[model samples]
Every structure is written in structure tokens, then in C-alpha cells.
Target: MTTPRIVVIGAGLGGTIAAYEINGAVGNRAEILMISDSDTYSFVPSNPWVAVRWREPEAIQVHLPPIFAKKRIGFTSAGAKRIHPAEKRVDLNNGESVNYDYLVIATGPDLAFDEIEGFGPNGGHTVSVCHTSHASEAADAFEEFCKNPGPIVVGAAQGASCYGPAYEFALILDTELKRRKIRDKVPMTFVTAEPYIGHLGLDGVGDTKTLLESELRNRHIKWITNARVTSFEAGMAHVEEVADDGSVKSKHDLPFGYSMLLPAFRGVPAVRDIEGLTNPRGFILVDKHQRNPKFPEIFALGVCVAIPPTGPTPVPVGVPKTGFMIESMVTAIAENFVEILDGKEPTHEATWNAVCLADFGDGGVAFVAQPQIPPRNLNWSASGKWVHLAKIGFEKYFLRKVRKGESEPFYEKLALHVMGIRKLKM
Candidate 1:
């Protein structure tokens, strides 16, 4: 019998994790082909540090060739332009094609700065941290601002999918300016579509609502929640601020010499128009098992999955899958895919389980909640020198393992259980 071909699109966190897991746990069971536009993986979680000059752009960027050689996996430095689910083939930007028995579309989100006029390729005015390039540009601008000293406004814009960066940028920049003794000369403001602090699009995790509010106050960062920025100019942000009584305030302008706003994410152009293949917003629709419902051969995890908000932004919000949860979902999906090919039914499901390490100005805080939703338990959070040291340690460990094609199941399991992605069966 011929070994099945497994094609993974977009070598980001989800796709890479899938490749490592399949190679480690089910190598002989399938032939894995990983496709990506670039040859290296950018460490996204550290982009905030790069924006504030804590990490160098080249430091977190890694090439894929070494890992492919050592791990014995096929790496394709090509972009996936389309998915012919019916034909079991993928289209490439270079007009080449690859056929596959199984397809995992983990290409992640395409930052839609275009949607927010004056951003992205369309020459949108605001700066962003969506990718390594964007982060680099923003960092350079940040340095210029520090040297020149100007009013700064940093926040996530309307429809942004990743909200953590906004919070981190605000805190990190605040710290950076203070270190230079120029913080008193700059006024920083946070603008967002989230209804309240810690809303983070997924709602709130643990005591996230109270936790974030308290932290922001302690750091002296002013915030405008429920704000929908209409547009940005060279030195001003025109925003429609939402009031506590659900009233709309018109055309309020916030001025700044430097700013960083997160953009909304849309699906890659290739996966568009595959009916029921994506949500209205263009994210792949997946079951708790992480398998595409429309096409069994397709699957998605991480920021690529389209999940409805549990409620509005102000409540305890929802869960985030930055560090731990993405790995867990990848593991379960890889194992489940192998089972189906082996004629074994799969019974694994991982919800939005997560343990997010958020960095603050002086230090950071780690939060974990089972199921990532309500009924919080076992509060295990701390801040200080150790937290910062551990954050750096984890990054090195993660990068090393990923480069070596090693899948750490212990972290995966802990992520699932701690975030309550898995509820213990009675």
C-alpha cells in the first residue's frame, strides 16, 4: 500500500506543529509535505519586544532548511494560492501544483490593513505589527520617536483579531520611555474595539477584566474601550468613541507622533470561495476536533480558526490560544488525522485551552484558566524578575524544539488541561 500524502499549507505555528507531530508520532504512517512562502518562521509572540527594541529582528527569525534536513521532512518554499478540495490538489502562486490525500490549511491570517483605509499595501497611514516586516518598520519609527520625543498613541484598531499586542505595546513603550527618562514628555493612549479591558476579542480569561484594568491604572496608560477608529492621519486618529450608556460620540481626534495599531485578519486569497469552507469573515470553520466540516481533508487551528465570541467584550471575555493552546490543537489534529488514515476513529477534542504569558512594563503576568472560559480555578499567577527570565527561557526552548522537529506532548497536555480545553470526564 502506498503511504498517504499529507500537505500542510502555511508554515506558521499551526502548520509547523502539525509537521513535527506527524513526523514524531506517525512518520512511517504518512508522507508529510510542508509548504510556506518563506523559508523561515518568524517568532510572532516576540514581535512586541522587537517593536520596543528589546529583541533584534534577525534574532527571532529562523531558516527552515536545517530542520527539514535533520527531521527528514519535505519543505516546499512555495505559496499556496488555492485549494481544490474536490480535486485533492493545491494551487501555487508560481503556477505549480501539488496533490494530496490530506490538507491542513494553517496559513494563519492575512492582515487586512486595507480594510482600515490608510494601512497596509494601500499605503494606509498607521503603523502595524502584523508581521516581522511590519514590526521592524514600527520599531524604527519607535526609535525615531524616542530620539525626537513626541506624543504617542498605541492601540488595536477596529476588527483586529490579535488584541494582546496592543496591550503589550502600550506597556512596553511606557517602560521604554521611562528607561530613557523621556516618559514624562510623551502621552500614550490605548484605543480599541474591545468593550472593556481584557476583552481581548475572546472575552476575558480568569480575572482578566479586573486584572487588566488594575494593571493599566498602575502603569498610567489611558485607554478608550469600545472605540472604533474611523481612520488615521499623519498625526491624528479620528475615532468614534462608545460611551458607557451605549451612546456614540462623533469624530473625536487623538493626536500622536507615533502609533502602532493591530489590523483585522482575513483568510488568504487562495482559500476564498470554497463554499462553507470559511466563515463570513474568511476564517476556516472547524469542529472541536479541528477538522473542516465541509471537506474532511482540510483542517485549521490557532488564529486561523473562526470562533464566535461567547458574549460581548465587557464580561469575563473569552479564551486566547497564543502559547500553549495552539500547540495542543496541533497535536490533537495531527494524531486524529493519522488515526483516520489508519482506519481508527478519532475521539479527541480540544477547545480554546490556553496559558498566555503577557509582558508588562517592569515585569509580566501569567494567567491560566481551564476551558479558557468561566468557572475559573487554581489561580497561579506571579510577576517579577523570575517571570521575565522564565519568559525568555521558554522562548529559547520553544524555538530549539521547533527547529529540531521535536513535539513536546507534555506541554501540549498541560495546555489542554490547564485551559480547560479538556474537562476531566467523571
Candidate 2:
């Protein structure tokens, strides 16, 4: 009998850990391979720090080739050009193809900066910290801006799924400026598409609105919510403030010497626009088990997965796939594959909980939502200096796990179990 092959696409946070966990689960029963665009794995959560020079790019990056070889898994950086789900084959950019009995698609979203004119780092006036490379360039820009500080703008764009990093980057800039004693010369403004301060695409988990608002107030950061950025000029941003009825309430021309606005995200080119596989936004459609209904052999997790908005808002807001939530999906898929190999139907499901530690340079906010949506069983949030330390610890610990090729180590499982947090549904 031929050994079944399992191929995982993308090597970001979710895909890399999924490969490790799946390999451990299936053992020699199946062959495992990973396809990534680059051999280096970057910790994206650290990108905000990279922008302020708090973290060097190399500190958060890991070379995957050596580690995958050590784990006895096939690794390639050729990247997929397109996914032929009907034929169970993936076409690579290098004119090669690979067939798989089971495939896991975890390619993270593509930043949609072009949707807004002159709004990104490429040829645009604003800067970006979405990628490590972009963050490095932003650091250089930051250094130059500090020499002659004027005004700063930071926030998330309309339809943006991720918001924590925007909040983090904004506050981190404040902290850095204060440290440099140039904050008084710089006016900071936060502009967002959310109706209120901490909607965060999950509808204000546990007093997040009050908490985030207080933070901005204490820092003297003025904000405009329900904002739609129409365009960005050399030193000005055109914005329209939308009302609850979806009509334009006002408009403003805000001037800034430096800006970093998080862009909206869509699925990568490889698996986009497939009729049954993706939604209109190019996000993969998955059932409760994280398996695509149209192609049972295809599964997906992370930012690329399609999740409906929590509710209707004046501006479109997308739900964020937090790290722990993505891990829950990864664990569920690994367990499901094990059941399939044992001649049983796949039954495992992820808990999809959201546990986030949003670090601000000095202090931070932490929140936990049991199911990551509104009306959840557990909704808790807090803020303290300890949260910032916890975030740093998490970054180091996660990097250590990747280096050791370990997933869900014994201590981590024990810690989560003690806290009554689980990755898989009961």
C-alpha cells in the first residue's frame, strides 16, 4: 500500500506549527511536506516592535530548512502558484506540481494596500509594519521623523481584520517619543473604521472599549472612529466619518509627518476565487471541523479562513483569528487526521477561543473570549504592566518552541489545562 501524503501550504505561524503537530500525530503512517514562499519564518506579532527598533528583524526570524530536515519532513520554498483542489494537486511557481491525499491551506492573508490610493509603503507616502522588511524601513523613517517631529497618525483601515497591532504600534510610538522627550512636539491621531474605540472586530470583549479609550485619553491621543480613508497625499489624509446609518457624517483633512495604517486583508492568489472553496473576499470556506465542504481532503486554519462579522456595523469589520484560536484549529486538524488514519471518520473540532496580550511599550491590555465571538461563555479583560512582560515572555517561549520543533509541550498543555483553556472541543 502506498503511504498517504499530507501537504501543508504556507509556513507562517499556523502552518508551521500545524506541520509539527501533524507529524507527531500521524508518525510514519503518512508522509508530511511543507510548502512555503520563503525558507525563513518571521514572528509577525513582533513586527510592531521592529518598527520602533525595540526588536531587530533577525531576533524574530527562524530559518526553516534546517529545522524541517531535522524533523524528517519534506520542505520546499518554491511556493504554490495555484491550488487545483478538484485534482488534489498544487502547482508550484517553479513549474513543479505535488499531489496530496490531504492538504492543509494556512496561507495568511495578502495585504490590500492598493485598495486605498497612496496608502502603503511601496510608492505611497505612508509607512507599514505588516512585514519585517517593511518594519525595518519604518524604523529608519521613525529615526528621521524624530529628528524633526510634527504629527503622527496610526490606526486600521476599513475592512481590516487585525486591530491589536495597530493599537500596539500607536502606543509604542507614544512610549518611544516620550522616552526621547519629543512627544510634546508631535500630535498623534488614531483613525479607525470601528464604530467605537475597542470593537476589535469581536464587538468589544469585556470592557475593552472603556479600557482602550482610557489608554488613548491618558496618552493624549485624539481619535476618529467609523473613519474611511479615501486617499493619502504627501502629508495629508482624506477621511470620511460615516454615521450609524451608513451615510457620510463629516470629512477631515488630517496632516501627519509620519503614519502607519493597517490595511485590509484578503486570501492569497493561490486559492482565491474558487467557486465553492472561497467566499467573495477570497477567504477559504470551512465547516465546523475546519474542512472545506467542497473538497473534504482540503482543510484550512488561521487568517485565511473565512469568518463572518460579529454583527452589522456602519463600517465593515472582520473578526481576527488570534494566535491561540489558530492553534485550536491546528490541534483539531491534527487529531482529525489521526482519526482518519485509524479507519474512523474525522470528528474533532477546535474550541476557537481568543486569548490576546496586546503589549503597549510600558503597559498593556489582555483579554480572553471563550469562543472568540459575542455572547460568549467567558469574557474577561485586564490591563497592567505585567501584561507587557507576559507578551515578551510569550514571544520568547513561542520562538523557543519553533527552534526545538516542539508543539504543545507538556508544560504548555498543563498550564492551559490548569487554566481550563482547551484547544479542542470536548
Clashes of each: 13, 0
lDDT scores of the candidates, listed in order: 0.74, 0.92
TM-score of candidate 1 relative to the true fold: 0.91
Work out the TM-score per prediction: 0.91, 0.97
lDDT of 2 by residue, 14-93 (tens): 99999999999999999999999999999999999999999999999999999999999999999999999999999999
Q: Give the per-residue lDDT digits (tens) of candidate 1, residues 1-426.
A: 888888888888777877888777776778888989999898887888887778888888878877877887888887888888889999888899999988888888877777665554236666777787788888887888877887777777777767777887788888888899998898878887788888776556656678777877887778888887777777888878776565675557888888788777777888876787887777888887888887887878877777766565421122344656677788778778768977987667764455666776577666664556554453334345444555676667667777677777535544334334455321
In model 1, what lDDT does residue 378 have?
A: 37
Deviation (Å) of 266 in candidate 1: 1.6
Model 1 ranges with Cα > 4 A deviation:
120-122, 244-247, 313-320, 375-382, 410-426
> Candidate 2 versus the native: TM-score?
0.97
